[model samples]
Target: MTERNTDLEARTEAKPLPRVSPATDILEREDGFYVYMDIPGVRREDLKIDINENEMVVTGRAGQAASEKETFLEVQFGPGEYIRAVSLSDLVDREHIKASLKDGVLTIHLPRLEKASPRRIPVQSA
Candidate 1:
């Protein structure tokens, strides 16, 4: 049954959101995690970020040439979309996620939630 549930989850994630798999780096620290993605030619205005539960979806569109119906000497433009998705673990604090984009690179910071511990009680020695 657990295997079936895992399969179902995989299928659900594969249903939508065509992923481009942009170059990315993930840095893990004691308190949090940082994600850096390189999306060249992508503009800041066309970037999108969506977070749901443990899933984070990012999509960005690169800028296009101003001229229309113009022939390019070299066809170097690939798909304009830059898409990536990440599944976070339970420790991540979803509400405190922060993101920024600069120089065609996007960075996201995910803070981890503090673990609960048993309260210490003081006792007087008889």
Candidate 2:
């Protein structure tokens, strides 16, 4: 086989490949920001969320087979790594961030830093 053919074969044989298309939502509030992601067929233990500085990373793996007799008909979504990185304008308090997954919907609450929150300053006449 030619080099191109070999590369194609390798690509076809690779398992657990990422699809790269995922639905996400980011909402900003007065107090903080909320990130919502839809990840179907993913278990709680299979999901991973990481936050570093101003970047947030979400990753998960979907199982390929539920049983030996079952097979995928339309395999757009498959057993693969799902990764997404988002940058935040507001400083986030990593220590207080909360995450929860329910019914394939992952919701993450990123609280803004204490110093980053908006404060009202008293005005004085000069």
Candidate 3:
């Protein structure tokens, strides 16, 4: 097993907001592609996904509440907007994309266009 190195300490030491530097994985299959990202402390309503001509953008924002009294902080994570942009190939079908978030994980499914997908053609003899 491989040990994972996360920047939790650095983030929490900086500020008191949710850090948004999520990691992502991209997988390509014969039919389509899948993109998985780890976005913690983000709700469904706080996420915004957009697909432009050749780019896919994911943006999230978490607001910070004002403290009522003096408080001692043990750790802090700067809270601000999280934005990530990815460029997609033309093979993807922009109209048939799907996204879902659960358990702090966001998954996006991009199906290849019918014209771009590989098809086995039958040979005919005249």
TM-scores for every predicted model: 0.68, 0.75, 0.70
Name the regions of candidate 2 deviating beyond 4 angstroms.
1-13, 71-76
Number of backbone collisions per candidate, in order? 0, 0, 3
Give the residue spans of candidate 3 off by over 4 A.
Answer: 1-20, 64-72, 120-126
- Residue pairs with colliding backbones in model 3 are 12-76, 17-77, 17-79
lDDT of 2 by residue, 1-126 (tens): 255444433444564465654599999887798999988878999998877777888988766544544433433444556788988666888888899999988999888999987789999999
- Residue 61 of model 1 has an lDDT of 74
Best by TM-score: 2
Clashing pairs in 1: none
Residue-by-residue lDDT tens digits, candidate 1, 1-126: 556444444433555433467999999876699999998777788899998877999989765543543434444344357888999988788888999998888999998876622357899899
lDDT of 2: 0.75
Q: What is the lDDT of residue 87 in candidate 1?
A: 91
Off by over 4 Å in 1: 1-19, 116-126
- For residues 20-100, could you state the per-residue lDDT of candidate 3 as single tens digits? 566889999766999998776678999999888999999886553424342434325434666778899998899999999
Better of 1 and 3 by TM-score: 3
Top lDDT prediction, candidate number: 2
List the global CA lDDT of all models.
0.75, 0.75, 0.74
